[model samples]
Target: MDVDNTKPKPDTVTLRWSYSPITYFEGPFRFKENNCCWEFFDGSATATINAKYPVNKSQIKNDLNKRIESIFNASLIYNHTPYKVSEPFMEGYDSKGNLWITPVPINLNLSVSGPNIVIKDSNGNAIEDMKGNRLRDIEEFAKLSIKYSGDPAAQAILRNYKSAVGEPNSEFCHFYAIREVLTTRFWSATKVRSCLNLKKDDWTKLGKLCNEIPVQQGRHQGQKYEQFRKATNVELEEARIIVKTMVKQFFNYLQNSESH
Candidate 1:
């Protein structure tokens, strides 16, 4: 019962589950956002196996272990640290060498009691009574939010989720040793050089233009001049911030809609 209460919870995944093949999920299970547990609605959660694909209990447990490994892999990085794999179901403590920032050891166990598939925390804590397909479920809510949010505020919410939890359904989080993989860098002067294929610091004027354009304008005048070299310093910064913001919003929109 010695759980590491000090570790931060970083607004962990808020998701829903499903068995039907709609939108982003085509497998036996799916994770969804804004999904209710009740079967009254169209996108509500469901048991992983209907009578159709009824897998044996042992097979189900093994699949659950594979899925748990997929969710938290020791080789991969989250917030620059690999998600440490722990023993099945029983809770794990940092012991004497425990660091303050690291997450508690992850649990990898599944069971079936009654008609439910049970997942346990490291300390033998029963986390959820899913129907033996919890880990592989798409983390629906996260997927839906990322795929359906079109507004700036909504897209921003999904961005915050991505920052907190590397996509739970990310390929490595989804394939292989289980799950595959999914920054932006460069300063104003460096950015200009890359766009024009020119040497760094080739033009002092662009640095000025990139700086002059205020962020509130919501427009990028990158093409006003015939050549990328023609851009001035202020215009470069102006164009940089303006174009960057626009692109950011656009991609966020695309990400939020791809699920459905």
Candidate 2:
């Protein structure tokens, strides 16, 4: 029998990859027509690999495993969590020639995920505004309120800075923000209208908008209200624009209160 020591091994390898928190895949990587490397399924890892190889398959698998482990180790060293989490993650490299990880992407992206927000410029830097130079939800709102209103009290109201049962204190959602701004007391609804010098027609229109929010506990107009439902994106955008206008107007009133 002739021994072939220089030949590459033919091994059945499995890899798993996961990008979403609740979804994953574990199996052989599909063959890419463009690239001729046996791989894991797109965006997944295999639990284990088993196959026959003329060369030492175990050693090759071991080496690959070590490399992957090192990448994760680098992530830890650089404070980058590899797993798909509430925070985003991406691959990177460090000065020590180790593949690292990052909670943010190497490329700047404007992403708004649930409670977290990321707004990067074309150069991948954080947007610097009155919101403390960090990316956050409602940052634009904050900047606008501060720039135009110059009133912290008004900003607080814009932020919906009070908590209620079933309502988040943060004003990230436009619908909730509109409701808070329209309903919260700058003293009282009457006083707010008086202070702003709003005409009765304007006040009635604003009041009607506030009442557009569906009743949380009971049927409205003989229709059941769904707790999970929210205003459509279109409605939210329109409401946001209207509320923004109102906030600016209210701030102006607050600014000239003594004069008025």
- Number of the top lDDT candidate: 2
Off by over 4 Å in 1: 1-55, 73-77, 87-260
TM agreement with the true structure for every prediction: 0.20, 0.31
For every candidate, C-alpha RMSD to the true structure in Å: 20.3, 19.5
Reference-based TM-score, model 1: 0.20
C-alpha lDDT (0 to 100) for residue 220 of candidate 2 = 37
Model 1 backbone overlap count = 43
**Model 1, 63-145: lDDT tens per residue?**
44444333222112211122222332211123332322223233333221223447899999888755333323324323333
lDDT of 2 at 174: 31
Error of 1 at 53 (Å): 16
lDDT by residue (tens digit), candidate 2, 1-260 = 12112222234333333332221112122222111132333234323334333335356445444433322222221111223312223232333434433344232222222222346799998765422222222222323343433344564543342221124211223334443554564646676657665555655543443344453311132343554244455543444454445554675665566466
- Candidate 2 accuracy as lDDT: 0.37
Q: Which portions of model 2 miss their true places by more than 4 Å?
A: 1-107, 110-152, 161-185, 199-223, 226-238, 258-260
